[model samples]
Target: MLIANYLLTCGILQANAASGMAVHDDCKLKFLELKAKRTYRYIIYKIEEKQKQVVVEKLGEPANGYEDFTASLPADECRYAVYDFDFVTEENCQKSRIFFIAWSPDTSRVRSKMIYASSKDRFKRELDGIQVELQATDPTEMGLDVFKSRVN
Candidate 1:
């Protein structure tokens, strides 16, 4: 519940850095929270030590179980209460897990999506489609389309 409340208050700030490779301080802090919460089902993170940056995308599901975390933040639609974690490996390999759990203002259940062991270059390449989708409304989600419009 604390994590959900924290995420609601800090969601907007995290969205700002979502599009860019740069890490947000609040997001970094969330990592600490997640690290402590990882027990069985909440444990979703990856590490890649050979890339220039590490990235993690969030799911739109509840934080209680794997089946509950299957929501993928839709390509361009901006959903409230979206949260994820990002961290760089010791060698800067760019390995980390990301989950996005969608919720209503009341924190009601919604879909959630997740990904792990993603490298910077590979993720960006894959994000090309996501960028195209975000362009219509969530231009900020793509970070200048660094991955380009290859998806379309």
Candidate 2:
């Protein structure tokens, strides 16, 4: 468990270079730890409007699984998450991939969607090791079937 005091200033999160939202350095640090060290199941992130920057919202325990990861995304908001995905390939070999998910539920506000959409690439670029990118606007869009399909 890390004692996080992360908050980004006006840096990343600008798709068109007209906005001020940014990603915290801790976000990239945590991602590196997850990518290189396998330290977390997933990391949830959100933009703190008051601060106008992206910040870490939650960290899944090392023992947590995919169900825990899917459940952690809110029903009516936008979020960014990184998940360590492990699977068995057709050749009976074990493999893992780092997935970056943009969870923007349909029920979320229009403004929220806009902000998340605009900032996604910048934030994604900050985390350099993500292997797969998934954008989910509904539950069915990101189900196990979808995950499996995208893995290959």
**Which prediction has the highest lDDT against the true structure?**
2
lDDT of all predictions: 0.31, 0.83
Model 2: CA > 4 A from native: 1-20
Per-residue lDDT tens digits for candidate 1, residues 1-152, read 45444543755223222232332344344444554453222322222223323334352233444224323333423232222333455566653343322222222122111111112234333321111212222323333232223221
Q: Please give the lDDT score for candidate 1.
A: 0.31
lDDT of 2 by residue, 28-144 (tens): 888888988889989999988767889999999889988999899999999999999888999999989888999999999866777787678888889998899999998798887
Give the C-alpha miss distance for residue 25 in model 1, angstroms. Answer: 0.7
Off by over 4 Å in 1: 1-20, 37-63, 72-152
Reference-based TM-score of each model: 0.24, 0.86
Candidate 2 local Cα displacement, residue 76, angstroms: 0.3
